[model samples]
Target: MMPDRSDLSAIAALLREVAGSIVMPRFGHIGPADLRTKSGPLDPVTVADEAAERALTEGLRALFPDVAVIGEESVAADPALLGAVAGPAPVFVIDPIDGTQNYAAGLPLFGLMIALVEGNQTIAGLIHDPLRDDTMLATRGAGAFLLRGAAARAEFLPLRVAAPAPLAQMIASVSWQYMAADEKSRVLARLDAIGQTPNLRCAAATYRAMASGHMHATVSRRTLPWDHAAGTLIVEEAGGHVRRPDGEAWRPADIDGGLIAAADRDTWHRLRDALYG
Candidate 1:
């Protein structure tokens, strides 16, 4: 069954509490000992990430019985749990801090993400901006919108992607760090037509920019569930488009072959063919 307004509200409240308690308090005050490098030098996880994920996981499990909780930090400790997201149970995907590097660097661009994936589809997803205390939320079939302010007194702002524009006018976010040496040069060589290609280094914020129309598209070579699931649903629900470079629909469990998102289907295809074709 689809989540009703009350259910969605509960999820939003939980996000707010988690941010207020675990995230904001330790944002710029992370001790060096509490931080460690992950896949690369640029990737770092702090105490806040672990605390927030643990808080959310426990709270969510109590709030909704029987759903598997898959957190980025948890998966790091046990690689086998990643397979559970593709299993039969509903999975609550969590990214306590989507941009830990930026957060650790004292930048306020990081955000929180949650998505409920059942089977191969994302049903309800949300991206919460702790710095601004606002959240972008969407459910399949229902529209997407922004909730700004305290949970009880938040304002609802409808979100929509920018209308299709000429390719030369479109802006995009592409992280060069995720690309290989040969493919990186090949892809960068073909981006002359875009207005600008900025790398936010934060998927949560990158997708927010796309869903709210500030950016026309984003190219992601890495597709972790916590990174893409919530953002993908929000963008698509806001009338944007998403697909793999190979033109396959982006399922919840599909992580290979990278992902492309654009203001519309035509723009997505044009950009994909030019860069990946």
Candidate 2:
């Protein structure tokens, strides 16, 4: 069954606790010894990421003993853990720190993301900003909301995507880091059609911006489940549009083929055509 408001609160509380204890404490204090390269120099995994993931995993298991937990750090050690997302049972996907590069550099732009996936579809999602102590959450069919302050005294504000705008007036976050050389060049050339294309290096923040109407869209060439699953659901719930570059719905099991999220379907189509057509 999908989580209700009470369950969402519990999960949010867990994220807050872990962020306060494990993530924020090490935000600007990371040392060379506390960090290590993952796929490459551009991909980093810090002590905070590992520690927070452990706490999150433990907390989630405690909350739902039967649900499988697939954390970025844990999956790095055991790639098979990712298979849980495609399984028949429910699974929780966690990204302890979404922008390790920024966090390691003392920039407070990272976030903690978690998504509950069942039957290969995301049923709920949460993105918590540790510094702001606010969370953007969404459960399928219930709409999206932003919760602030402690759980007991939390205030939930409804979230919505920006009103539709012309392609030339839209601002977007475009990630070209993993794109093929030829494809990257082609997309970059077409980006001039948009008003602005900034790279925040944090998917959580980008999704938040799009959901809250601060930005119009985002285009990502890499679609890792931990990175996009939660954010995509949040945006869609907030009345945005999301799909792979080919115009098919994005699923938790999709690892690549690019993804586009926009304020609406018309914007998505325009952006897709500008970038690929």
- The 10-residue segment with the lowest total lDDT in model 1: 1-10
Candidate 2 clashing pairs?
none
Kindly list the per-residue Cα lDDT of model 1 for residues 1-277, writing each as its tens digit: 4777667777888998999999999988877897998877877999999999999999888888877898999998998888876876689999999999899888888999999988868888999998778899999989898987765677778899988877688798877667788879989998887778998889999999989989999998878899999999999999999998888888777765689989899999888877877
Which candidate achieves the best lDDT against the true structure? Answer: 2
RMSD of 1: 1.4
Instruction: Give the per-residue lDDT digits (tens) of candidate 2, residues 1-277.
Output: 5999889989999999999999998888999999999889988999999999999999999999988899888988999888888888999999999999999999989999999999889999999999899999999999999989885799889999999888888998999989999999999899889998889999999999999999999999888899999999999999999999999998998887889999999999999999999
For model 2, state the Cα shift of residue 184 in Å.
0.8
Point to the candidate with the largest TM-score: 2
For model 2 the local lDDT of residue 107 reads 92
Q: What is the C-alpha lDDT of each candidate?
A: 0.87, 0.93
Give each model's clash number: 0, 0
